[model samples]
Target: MRVALGVSYNGQSYDGWQSQPSGRTVQDQLEKALGKFADQRISTLCAGRTDAGVHGLMQVVHFDTSAERAPYAWVRGTNSFLPRDIAVQWAHVVPDEFHCRASALSRRYAYSLLESPVRPSVDAGRVGWVFQPLDLAAMQAAATRLLGEHDFTSFRASACQALSPVKNLLRIEISRRGAYWRFEFEANAFLHHMIRNIMGCLIVIGQGKQAPEWIDEVLAARSRDAAAPTFSPDGLYFLGPRYDARWGLPDRTPAYDWLP
Candidate 1:
């Protein structure tokens, strides 16, 4: 049987979503816990691979397992062996044709930023920090240039293995509340470090270091060197993927409410 799981984790402790020889990645820990629960080795494929220090509010993953157990059993059992920072939020039996990654229509991500003169203390690993005040209008204007389909090579990372540099960015919402800033992004797919690179540019524009139209110049350049440096991943969160309703997968986990 094929099973789908909605997992949530505080990524501060793990290297990333993928497995590594160091055995300190989210995937490695998850698989190990699953193996202990199922009494056999199991593998998983996630909807998206988050980078180091990137949290996940609802990370979907699917794996084929012969172990016949109730959905709740899988959740509780696997989580019993996992660390406190990671937990399997929900589980459901899925059709063999359902692929966690391939079935996603679009992926969503959010970055929480703290705007303050002093560095973050309470939420140090949970948010990015910017000492200088930011202009909301300026950042929004700069973000507008990134909407729609375009070659995002300027924002793509050098080690990105994506087949193409073109991606359709569906939305970019920037909102501020008190000293907190939230930037949300939805896209058909993302290249490695794409959002972080864009965040660097937007923050620059927000601080008056560059004009809003500079985003256009960076896009036209199609060179990574033309864009600003990649921002910190501390605030990045994988909001999960959008799948067809026919799949009957849960759109979100309860952890969504906990995010700022």
Candidate 2:
């Protein structure tokens, strides 16, 4: 039978979401934990691969199990085996056709910032600690121009292997809540490091380092070099993927294990 698991992780200690030959990864760690509970290897397909040092709040993975286990035990038992930095938030048994990544209709990501003059040493692992105040209004204005369907070559990685650069940006908004500035984005799919790259360019504009109108120019350029440097990985999170309810899950829920 197939089962889907929701996972949350601190990405600092690992290479990325995939299993790597040279370094530790979330998949490697999760498989290690699975050793105590099952005989066969527990291989999971993620909603998407988060780059090195990128955290997650709602990454979904699915694996097969020969022996029946309680749905909730996948959470409690896996949590007991896994390290504190990585956790299993929930699980649901599903049909074999239910995929963690391929079936996703849309994905959401969030970029977080600490906007203040004083450095924040405490949440250094949780957010992009910026000691400069950003112009939230300017950032929001700039983000709007990039909305809608377009070829996002500028923000994609140089080595990005995606066959197509075209992606639909359902919504992109910049909102401020107290000392934190958030860039919320929902899209049909994302190119490699797309959200982080967008945030880096927007940061420059927010800090008066670049003209807000330059965003349109960068998008038009459609070249990786035309965009700003990709932002730090810590501030970004693969929030979750949206799927149809017929896949044996609810349409929406307030609970998220992978919020970054």
Name the top lDDT candidate.
Answer: 1
Candidate 2 local Cα displacement, residue 106, angstroms: 0.6
Q: Which stretch of 10 consecutive residues in model 2 shows the poorest summed lDDT?
A: 251-260
- The digit string of per-residue lDDT tens for model 1 on 77-193 reads 999999999999999999999999999999999999999999999999999999999999999999988999999999999999999999999999999889999999999999999
Over the stretch 185-237, how does candidate 2's per-residue lDDT look in tens digits?
Answer: 89999999899899999999998899889999999999999999988988787
What's the lDDT for all of these models? 0.96, 0.83
Could you give me the TM-score of model 1 versus the true structure?
0.99
Q: The CA-based lDDT of model 1 is what?
A: 0.96
Off by over 4 Å in 1: none
Question: What's the lDDT for candidate 2?
Answer: 0.83
Give the root-mean-square deviation of each candidate in angstroms: 0.7, 2.0
